[model samples]
Structure formats: structure tokens, C-alpha cells
Target: MTEGRPLRADARRNRERVLAAAREAFAAEGISVPLDEIARRAGVGPGTVYRHFPTKEALFHAAIVDNIERLTDYARELATAADPVHAFFGFLDHWVAEGAVKRDLAEAIGSDHALELSSPVKGMLDSIETLLHRAQRSGGVRPDIDLDDLLRALKGTFLVTHIPTITDAQRRRTFAIVFDGLRVR
Candidate 1:
């Protein structure tokens, strides 16, 4: 997984499998998912995972970055959609739905750490701001809200849904309330 260096075909496949497994595992179970578990999920040996990612931090960061990059890209794409109101609310719904169960995603962007405020995260924030501004201008979202407000609301939604005992019905109800608060009417 070295930069600019090509891996052998089998090695590359193994790496890809490991990364996919890591992403899915982290998304579903958080960073605490064991390397061995990831290996089993990938159908590779634990040594293969270690070979590609020497440390859990390395694998975790890579998976988190990949997920964040994907989310940012999706938001940027939606920024140009014909309906900003739909795009903005749909994106919020997507995050609330996925982030509720994605512990690693919640932890990655939910923090105030140095890395959390840098390029990757900033890119996502910019996209969200674009959608938020467009929606506000269209009178679909409350004009009083800012990026920080929306982000806080998103974080709160993620946290509340992460409660182990929260039912799916309750989670949906919670997000319905939060989303209603964000809407203009």
C-alpha cells in the first residue's frame, strides 16, 4: 500500500479485499473490530491484513478517509442538483441514516482533533455549506441556521441513535423531529 509503488496482482487484490472488509467492519462495528475479524470477513489471513496495514491506526485511518472522501464527493455532486432543497434534505437523511450506525464515521468527524478540522473534513463542510445555503435561499430551510448549527444537529442525531437500546422506530422518530426543526415550515 505504499504510495506510487505498484503491488503484485494478488497482493493488490488482497489489499483491496482487506480495505473493503475494514471499511465495512468499521462502518458497522466501529474501530474496535478486530484485525482477525476483518481478515475473516475478507477471507484473508490475519497476516495479510497486517502486511497491508501494519497497525490498526493505519487501517482505521485509511478506512475513515475513504468513507469521508466518498461522502464529500457525493455531497459535491448533489451541490449542483436541480433541486437544492431536495438535495440538501436527502443528504442529511443519508448521513443520519448511515452515521447512526457508523461508529467510525461518527467518531472520525465528531471529534475536535487536529485531523478532524483539516482538508478532508473541511471539504465535506464546504459541500454541506453549499447545499445549506442553496436550500436557505430557496426558502426550504430555516435562514437562521449556519454550518455549525447543522453539524451540531447531525452529530446529536448520530449520538442519540448510537444508543444500543434505541429502537429503529425511535431513531426514525428522533431524526424526524430533528429534521422538522431544520425545515423552514
Candidate 2:
């Protein structure tokens, strides 16, 4: 029903604006922000937003996929750090802190069946697993822990620290306590 060609310059600009607005809105207000508000923020009409993203779910999924890809890239970069243990824990700390404000995004990814199967998500997990294995082999992490343990610890940490009433200091303290448990005795 549509031509399979590159978008025109104006159309491409409009699409980029829409995605940028959507990312900001989703980060500040979660995925519940109205499409019209996103369109207004992008200086585009609602029809233009709809033309670029057929539904809010589609837009949110795109954002999540984009985030996963970026995180995977970051993990890949961290993988080459001189200290494997520091690299692993640094990645974990950064991930949990970033995810603290993106609780809605976490919930959406957890619930979305399609997103769970996405290659970016899988790549992120694999990268994490490799990091964990490297740290363990270096005797920095406890040998008994595996990738699943690390994931569960991060999920638990995020769930516990992401509450609105919790102060930043409290979150850091809690994360420190949990993270300490992962180190070799």
C-alpha cells in the first residue's frame, strides 16, 4: 500500500523530531503520555506522529529496542576495560541507576512478549553473561554466582530502590550493600 523508498527530507526530519519528542516524553512521563502531546512537542501534527508510528505501543517498543541496543554497545565497550571486575560492577551500577527512573520501561519490557524475543535484548543479556564470567574467572566475583544470580540481584535492586519515596542516598546505600555481597570473600 505504500512505496518502499527513502523518505523525503522533510518527512525524514519530521520522523526524527517525532522520535526525539517521544524519547523525552517517555523518559520524563513514561509511556502514558498522549500522542498529541508528543506531536506538539515535536512541532508536528498528530497525523504526522501517527504516520511515523502507527500506535503508542509501536513507539514505545522502538524506544526500548533502541535503548537495548545502546546498552549492548556500552557493555561491549566495557568488556575491554583493563579490570574485568571493575568493569562488571561498573556496568551493573550504571545500568541499575539508569533503570531507576525508567521503571515503566522496565515493566513494559518485562511484559512484552515480542520484546523479550528481540535480538538486542538477547545481545545485552549475552554481554552481561560474558562480563560476569570474566569477573568470576578473575576471582573478583564469587564463583558460586552465575548470570541468573546477577540478573536477579539487579532486578531486585532496581525494584527496591526505584520507589519514589526513596532518597538518592538511600538508593546508593542499598545498592552498595547488595553489590558488596557479590564480591569474593
Candidate 3:
């Protein structure tokens, strides 16, 4: 039996299970969910969890990145939307949802946004930049605004969800305020 090949299938299944469990746990209880609980939810031992992800933080990072890639794909579709305003709002809604889910990605990834986002980030940025350019051409968003600032603001909004006892409605209201603020006067 090939040494590496023998473990490949089992390893892939374990990783997938761990990620699914971690996603549910994080969504239900935020980032503070215990690793042991995640392992139990996955029907795996704690040692297996460790073998896959050494720390809760690392597992969280993986989940966050996975979610980001999916969102970025959605953003790609939005970029081609016929309505520029709708496209912008689509991107906005995506950021808000991802923020609501994992408030710590911005902190772990950093302001530069180079981390956590690999090729998918680049693809999304290209789409976003093109869309922003089109919107600017149509006199939608402010011409003076930079995409980097928008990204930082979006990340900031996500970070706000981590605050204790903030309701989802409150987060939406805050996002509305920021969204209106970003619009061209």
C-alpha cells in the first residue's frame, strides 16, 4: 500500500467533518465554542481534532477562509449584475453576513488583507474594482472613494458583531448608517 495514499481519503473526510462541525459551532456560539465540543459534534476524538487543527484559532481561520471564498464567488456573480446599485448592495450584504458569522477574520487576517485571502481575494478584488469603476462612470459611488477604504470599513463593520449583546437588527442598522454615509451626496 502507498503510505501517503492510504491516509488521503480518511484525512480528507476528517478535515471535512471538522470544518462542518466548526462552522456550526461558530455560528451557534461564536468563536468561544470549545474544541472538544466541536470534535464531539464531528463524531471524532479530541486527538483527531488536534491532528487536523492544533488550536481553535487555526480551525476558525480555516472556516473563515472557506466562507470568504464562497462569498467571493457570489461577489463575482454580483459584479456582472445589470444594476450597479444592486451589485454594490450585494457586495455590502455579503460583507455583513460574513461579518455576522465570523467577526474575528478581520483581526486575524489584518488590515492589509493579504492573509486569509489567497487567490480568491485577488479574483474578488478584480471584480470589485471593475464594478466600482463602472459605478463611478455611471456617477453612482463617490469618485473620490478608494476601494481599500471600503474594504476596511466593511471589515470594521464585521468586527462590531463581536461586541457583547449586540442584536442582529442593531448590526443591520449600523450597516445602513455606514452604507448611507458612503453614498455620493
| Error in Å for residue 163 of model 2 | 2.7
Tens-place lDDT per residue, model 2, 1-185, is 14698898999899889888888787656677899999999999999988978888777667677777877888999998889999999988777667767664454434444655677778888898888888999999999988767766776776677677899889899889888999998
Evaluated at residue 112, the lDDT of candidate 2 is 47
On lDDT, the leading prediction is 1
What tens digits encode model 1's per-residue C-alpha lDDT throughout 1-185? 58798899999999989989998998888777899999999999999999899888678877778668888998999999999999998998787766877887776665655546767878888888999999999899999999888877777777768889999899889988998999987
* Model 1 vs. true fold: TM: 0.77
- Clashing pairs in model 3? none
- Candidate 2 error regions (>4 Å): 1-3, 34-36, 100-113
TM-score of predicted structure 2: 0.78
Collision pairs in model 2: none
C-alpha lDDT of residue 116 in model 1: 66
Q: Which ten residues in a row have the lowest lDDT in candidate 2?
A: 104-113
Global CA lDDT of candidate 3, please?
0.72
lDDT of each: 0.85, 0.79, 0.72
